[model samples]
Target: MQHSLISLSILAALASSAVFAQEQKEDEANDKYTDRIRILGSSDKLRTLGGAASLIGELELESFEFDDINRVLSTVPGVNIREEDGYGLRPNIGLRGSTPERSKKITLMEDGVLIGPSPYSAPAAYYFPMISKMTAVEVFKGPAAIKYGPNTVSGAINLVTREIPEDFDMGIDLAYGSDNYTKAHAFHGETAGKWGYLVEGLLTQADGFKTIDNSDADTGFDKTDLMAKLKYDLSSTNTDQFIELKVSKTAETSNETYLGLSDDDFNQNPYRRYAASQVGLMDWDHDTIQLTHFIDFQSVDVTTRVYRHKFSRSWQKVKGFGNNAPSIQTVLLDPDASGNQDYYLRLSGQEDGKIVVGNNDRRYVSQGIQSDFGFKFNTAHIEHIIDAGIRVHQDEILRDHFEQDFNMLAGTMQNPQNKIFTTVDQEKSTTLALYIQDTIKLDNLTLTTGVRREYIKTHYQNRSDNANAKDDWLDKEFSIILPSVSAFYAMNNDWGLFAGVHQGFVPSSPKQNDVDVDAEKSVNYELGLRFAMQNTSGEFVTFFNDYSNLKESCSFSNASASQCPIDTDFNGGNVDVYGLEANLKHNFALTTDLELPIVFTYSYTHSAFKESFNSDFPQWGNITAGDEVPYMPNHQLSVLASIVHGQWQLNLLAKYTGEMQEAAGSGVELSDKVIEAHTTFDLSANYSLSAQHSLYAKIDNLTDEDHLVSRRPDGARPTKPRQGVIGYKFRF
Candidate 1:
């Protein structure tokens, strides 16, 4: 079946290319009179690439006041974002059908630079850029993402920050919503002669809606962000050069938890929290500094950047109820079961439960220097655009973890242990990467080919408190080469076709107990078509991924002993994933001179483990041949409609997420292990009071429907209730 699909895709591409060639030849005489359009860093160029890509600009971001990336990304086809925390503090992003845990399978960036705390050593996204402060977002999927990095098995997501403006400008935004949610964002920028500067700050806080039935602690978060940028332009009679310096800081405190309620408890009160999780909290701080230089020449453009980033976080949460007790998830699934009743009673504070609290404290630092050169020239009637880049990076993670035991007395945590136990686990890595790609353009056809080389050296150590315990450092080295090719043909001004195939790569989890593992590798293919007319535009794409090895890591903090040994790894030998994505947008003009815009997006994904032989990982429990990959919905759909008048705009958005299995299984037969399908609607309105003033209002989940969002790491969790916000913006 897969082979037949591949053949049909190839045939379609060839047919389109032949038609394009004939059209080009027919219009040969008028080629000289046609004007060429070029946008250096624009969405049009990205969309026409031989793969699936989408650029969400400021206007689209403001349409619904979507500060949460999951909500904003729903409009894009083939992009899947899982909601963990009600707020998008840490997004679990998946491209195509890759795993979405911690967003580790994909490449994440800010301002075109890798933003992971430790991209090379510990790629878990403990810290994410603030989406409310970003000016734009760029999503690159399929084979084109090979240019980004060592974790491109999925794709790449780039957050574009606000840049220094060419002229003086100032703006302020304020909003208040349900749950006492408040936000304030302000920014100012100016350019004077050869110098330009910008400063921005954001503050947001909320009093959460969920109730801690046994405690008075606020289940909310407070966050602050500050950024500054300086730019200098050096323009002379012979050359042009520019330099930019940027610094940013972020701090956040949230009372969050991974411990959820039992099925009965959830049914009674979906927003209730267990007393054992009263101490669950996360506090973090991040700082970054970057310097970039740009040089422009007659035929080439060069850019160099040097950056350093540091992050520190301390998350204190309930790790376990007792040594011999059932896991939180097991008790939640069947609280009345024989052995689970006792555990459920302990979690409810009716019994003496030795609650284990772990202080997961960690610090990370990443620094790198990278440069990119782009050259454009023409030779033998063919235009060539070549891009090459190289990077050297070093990153590490330092951990100082400790734990304490306590008991809940009369619905209150008491009898805390005075003695605390500690352990250390650290990892460091040094990496070098180089990549080059050339795009060849001839009349109506364009071909792009690229290759990347990566070399990495990693070291890990585990320190024990016992004097007799053995402590030694282990080292490992890896080298990988990846290549890709793609083609795009413009059949005419209104029709086009593209296709590409590339190799995907992802580094294995850090060594565990002196066990070295091989890296995960896959071959990915994509074929798509683009169509645009006077008032309509759309794209349809089909993608397939063949994985040689799929890997999963287990953490003691989240997984139970029955799931997998702590700090162990599980490999799912081979897998196959295929999907289809389609998106369309159209504009209609009314008789009253008003315009209405409609947008539609849909995706279908089918992923399965081809040769499943499971070892002890609960996520891949008793895997069998043709078992579907967990947590990936087979169908997703969204629609948007907007009305535009003189100075007012209104939009209505609706989204549907199909049912999916919560664990690796043949089908969704078990209710506890299935995430049911759900639909949500949103409404937004914006009005311009004047040239410098505007007002906006948004209401999310307008129907106030209750639904389960996830059942992972622990027990089932519900999505946030309806929320409404009113805001005002001022500009000068």
Candidate 2:
């Protein structure tokens, strides 16, 4: 029975080489389409996983109907998120004690494949998938993380999409909300003969919640996503085999900016955008195609996946005033400090001045092929299951940046200068990953050991008009071997304990000079307990990461142009991070027809540098032996409660995120100009009008709580204000 529990999601894909590939239904084992990368979405699999993992299923995902990944992740322990844009667009996410900047320190995937724009060259998720169309989300951590690859320092996240149905089915969801927001989502799936197919589409648009100075321009965004999947079973081959093809496209246009309000301006109106930022905007398009082949033999299983992704993005936003060299932080922190008065006045549209804007245009290509093999054997009284995989991935990033000078006349642009090339560059990486994991089970104990080998060759070419970058376009290569071990012991049918240790690594960006920076390396450890009693079940885990050499990658999304130059690596020396994660859930029977379901999650994280150092990297500047890491919260908590009676359900959620620092400093960093602690609540009510129709109403930030969310990459930013929405759903 234990061997039959197939691992899908991260468990199979474990790190870079898939181990369990999928979870197969005993009855549907012959139809590879029936297998799912569940990511241990069920409690039973998680209890014996020998690691820490969480699954957000359809029931919970549709409860709040959250279109934002940040809000949804709050309910998972050990996750840290930094909110921006009020919406979850371009989310800053972290697991355990990893940096939450741009979510580059972890592995991100969709349906068991890497999904970041350029996971190997430019990992920043400037274009994340639409969460509204996802059927489930899986979070993986601990030693198991080593099985997932590239950035095992933190963890991994996999977004699972809807699968082709076995029977005819279709559904549609429509909603209207505040700020002129609108959403439409529809999906259809059916099986015919030996073929199964699914088609889905989603559209979301909004007028934005921010007001522009002397302008009525919308600050919101519009996004569209379409996907189609086709699968065919090859029963005619006289063996259990199937092939599936998936194709998807996404396009978006958002009027967003990196510029935030000054401290004084934010205090007065946190939602106001300065006239200088009127040019802020971004447009992007992404397309992906994937093909998968599955074969089930008498003694082994095989899964082969081939995927390719192409993405293009163009963003135009205010760079600065005049020379565009002065740091925005300097002027915003003290607008009346004589030297900053002119910049401040001009920013607020109170004075006519020349402003500079820049356009960041980039294209990305990511393609890879991976194969997995799994088999079972027995030796004496012990049983063993072995999973081995190989993957070859190549990704590239092409960058072209331009800047122009503009004259601001009375809060409106007057004359504009011709665009000039600022930077032109390209980065590429070719990676070969091989991994194998063995799961040994004897009685009530399950033990797993795995090793992953990585070989990466990278190249960077800079063709900037400026001399800041080298033109050599040199290539560099690096290789490493990582090992992991974990075990789970069942104390009884209701209690289990797990522990693991693994070697973690994160590769340097292809643009790195190699001589100055070594790839990030660390040893990670975790221990936990799983318990279930009646309708109550919970997990408690503690993790620690000891870094021998930490590295920081700078990006415009989290750091200033002057703080840390883009496409560069900064050495962080030695460091240590430790944390605890706890999650509990229970259901109470109120009556024969009513029930109450509750879930609670909490996270505590702490980090410290081993040696004192000074650097331009904003988050790690002037680090001391005992100084805490910036942007890392000490406490995070989330609670979800819901009542179900007949065909009616009501849900409430509360989240609390502790204050964070813009830069590493004392524990009271918030005392300065850092983000302050904040709490928010959300409510949702849903009623099923027969089995074919349903209605729902929801409100975000129900308490109208106002708080500062960040202070870097510009000036000051705030959380979203209160908003509400109503929707209807139809399914047959």
Candidate 3:
């Protein structure tokens, strides 16, 4: 039959040309990924201008560590966190006035590394990261934090983590809040063939809001964590290799003592436990190891850390009623250990220039072995975009055992001249450095400049006693050269205009278990303005920081009639500070449709101490020059707001602190309330039915208000309370 009609018309024209070549290859792969990953996550003013505390995810992860991350960063307006006798153990973070204890001036990072405090210790410990796998947080204050380097004179916090995307996924979160709190978390990722994996775990427990009555002990908190990551892909130029491991532990039990409200037992029994049944005990542990290598696009890194701590205290159980009541119990401890070994080699790529080299080795038998070398430079010209770096460090500070225990809150039967010895004291040091930076763009104006130069060398050997304590090794060295500048202007397209000036240094911390000292300087100035439309935004600043010679650790005069053994005193002073900071943000798309956020911040801090320290100490006291610097705080305001429709979300936060001075030479008896800033609130909800499933809920300190976040009161300390929480989350 005519060859069956020509083979059925050639099989219907080859099935219509293979269905038009599969619809033209699916419209050219959907126009190259629908606009480059949706312009990298909905570019809202470039994600709030590269986030530096314009309030980012989870409100910039404030809690620093726990307290439910300050119940979600206290709703943002003017953050403030406190915990005197609560669960978060010893927690406090007051923005604006910049309080966060040894936080010095805020500068924390994770992912991008740098865990803070330990440039060679002397009162510097509090990096404490591991926020159960944080995903985002970035805040930059002061002179925009000068790109993260040494406290930045008051701001820089970045904590971003989350990289498991390669397919298969899993997630889990569980919680029970309000006092007995309780938390759990888990995550998993996969990619079998080329090998890729991720694992995470966390557990938390709390049983406190403060409600002890004389002593039953246990105002508790406990934590545990584990993390693992691995990846290896070598598909010809697909190169990649990464391995990560982490371990953590946390514990805090307290009865509270900063000594503020005790006038007849303050409120009769405000979480009271008349000191002594073992008040305040802490145990902390952390471990980390990392190795990464990515090719083509460059990346090489290695990191290591092992930290251990054991602290115990009990100082209040010696009362007499009618027969010399003696029930003795006063204790202290130092079962501690520390370690750090880091090495990095970087050469990032993305069509831009980047290079890095680093080394940091630190051991703690009393702080020794601190070797460093770092360099970096990133470039782009046409429209400018450059970042630079340089660093060199060296150390030999072997003189451990509570630093030859010179009475840091004496004990052991009440200071029998204070005993607790452990020494290595073979001090040797060298720290050479160089730095340079630039960020420029003309059309709409943008400029940033930097410079740094430093050199220091010192040596001291074996000294159980160096006459009055601060030996000046032969011709020890000290040199400094610092400079910085910043500017930005971009009216049109949402406005912008900013200004800056900067300088900072720190070179003293080795009161000669042998030698090393002469490095403490600061100079900073700023002016600013930056605003945007969509999603609302704002940033305004005015600041000044002046510190010279600084260095403090006094107590040498008349060394106990020349018994001279060594009583500590390494003085040098000068300090002047000034500031004004304003930040605002809003994201409202007519309520309930999703996304309604707002944030605000205000600050003013002033300090002085041109010099003068020995009139029974007190006009700010201690390492003198006017003393108000210890944790700076002289008026601050804050606020945060939120509202998210669909699945519910509501948040609000607040903070206010003014007046602070509690160290240097404490004459005691001062209390404009060293730290009295607080306010917090939170709420959350989530529900999704597909794409892996989801359900969530959260509430923290909704209103339980009544606060006093922190106060060392210089010496008699006591102040911390007010807490609440609730949570639940799951995804698969």
Candidate 4:
């Protein structure tokens, strides 16, 4: 029934939807006329940045047909990812050495708008846009990332959607693969007179690869996405203006569990699912509506957006045999222990017992209005671009969490007990933010200066409180001011230098604030050298983030939570994270009609706690001053190569993620807490049937590499096995 949200949006739109760069019309340029919805409007905007940025252009994305955000972002430098589900239903992305848990440390956006459920109140990315539907991806780091506050410590990513075509245009794609994976994508867009519109829909489903004990349930997931956009153009001689409205809906249902296997059990079969997890399931729906107005007056322009998004979700997963029992991880790690073997026996259905499952029902609302004013002027023959912006945003989260007890008979839940309301958490945040940035250009030197100020107000109610009295609620207020400066110098056509320094901040959750948890703050610095040569381009950069107070959040999703309260913060005092990134790209011409392009990216990160502290946090147990940060791999590398010939293209990509520690420590890594290193390769081929039709095939995990990706929440989790798919696409 949750799928009805998108269906309703379609009816309301009966209303309104660049699959790729080469597919767009050359004469119709959205950038030249109106204000852009994208952060980096074009490749030309990248040049030599005051900071570092990456634009995964349409040419590359369209060629790869990557449905997973993790796969897409792995090609970029300075990005670290931890794979959870074989598919990227939930992505853990970290910029530099920031935390990669649920991507809460980084800012996520679509078309320049915050896309998280409730960015300011609850930043966990339970709802992420489909990657296959995006046209381009823009990533910003360092000082330049401050513009997208409340989360400036890690950085920001913008997912660009397709725009309406100049004329009538439409496309359809269909594919089927291993494990009963299927995909259907279609879109249509057109322009008439001064009005234009676009409508699009996507559906992907699969029969999960894992087999559950004594259960026939489909362990996979099904997802649906729908969108509508309407636009009215009001343009004249010296001015350009337009009003656009966008509506979108996303829904999903997946049978996933946090239960993992013991090391001995994992060694026998990595993909096995315990019988106790047969009841695990999750359902979620999200809806959004946004209106934007843009107008240009010669050298000055103004653009504003008003948006509201709503998200609701419910996840029912196994808790344990008893409420006070040890965490699942504890038992899975040492099943031979006297107290742990019984839990393990019940999990495997070897003995009948009562089971407890928790259902976290959550609702989120995020609404905001933001505007930007741009000015272009010249002073003393020097060109300058000035931008100022202001935003007033409010977001809230309401969680109605409860648990139920069930009698398990042969791995299936029977006689369920009455549901118990375990907790009710309500939190909200309102923020007023203002920022101004100036870009000065003279000769071959460019300098950028920017400052941002934030005024935040928050309210929270203590968990498990049933009273409505004002005394049961807590309110708090705070302010933060951040400043940044960066410079770029072009020594010649082949070489350039860039450097930047900025203040970074990530606010604690509203409830966390009510508990007097301190927000995270840091001073970040970066320096880089860029070069261009014959048929090749490359860059080398180094970055350092010195945090006066670093904060880590603990939840059942990424860490063992028995030692600490749920959804609480742990202060990691005085920490420094330093890293180096390198990237190189080159194009080789095998013949006049055949061309090969290759790209490589590498990153090395080192983190240390400058002050020793004692803590019971599961992920940071017994921290020493020089102990390394957990879940941070010291080395990462990615390589992408494509062979293009007449009417055909073949692509191969391989990535290596170094070993990581589950808990913080230094010296020779302990054997038990280490997540071993692994490398995987993917291959794809595309053949053009005509200008309007194409055929493509791809094989993921070409070598069927089975390796532990993480040991979090539960036990060992493995990557996807080898899977292949063939598909056809049509466009006009």
Score every model by TM-score: 0.92, 0.94, 0.29, 0.94
Q: Model-by-model lDDT, in order? A: 0.80, 0.85, 0.44, 0.84
Worst 10 residues of 2 by lDDT: 18-27
For all candidates, what are the clash counts? 0, 9, 25, 2
lDDT of 4 by residue, 441-495 (tens): 9899999999999899998886675565345676889899999999999999888
Better of 1 and 4 by lDDT: 4
For every candidate, C-alpha RMSD to the true structure in Å: 10.9, 7.0, 26.3, 8.6
Per residue, candidate 3 scores C-alpha lDDT tens digits across 132-220 of 56765555554445444544444555555555556788877676766666778788888776677787777776665554433455555
Write the candidate numbers in order of decreasing lDDT. Answer: 2, 4, 1, 3
Looking at model 2, the pairs that clash are 12-18, 12-19, 12-20, 12-21, 14-147, 14-148, 15-147, 15-148, 15-149
Worst 10 residues of 3 by lDDT: 340-349
Q: What C-alpha lDDT does candidate 3 achieve relative to the native structure?
A: 0.44
lDDT of 2: 0.85
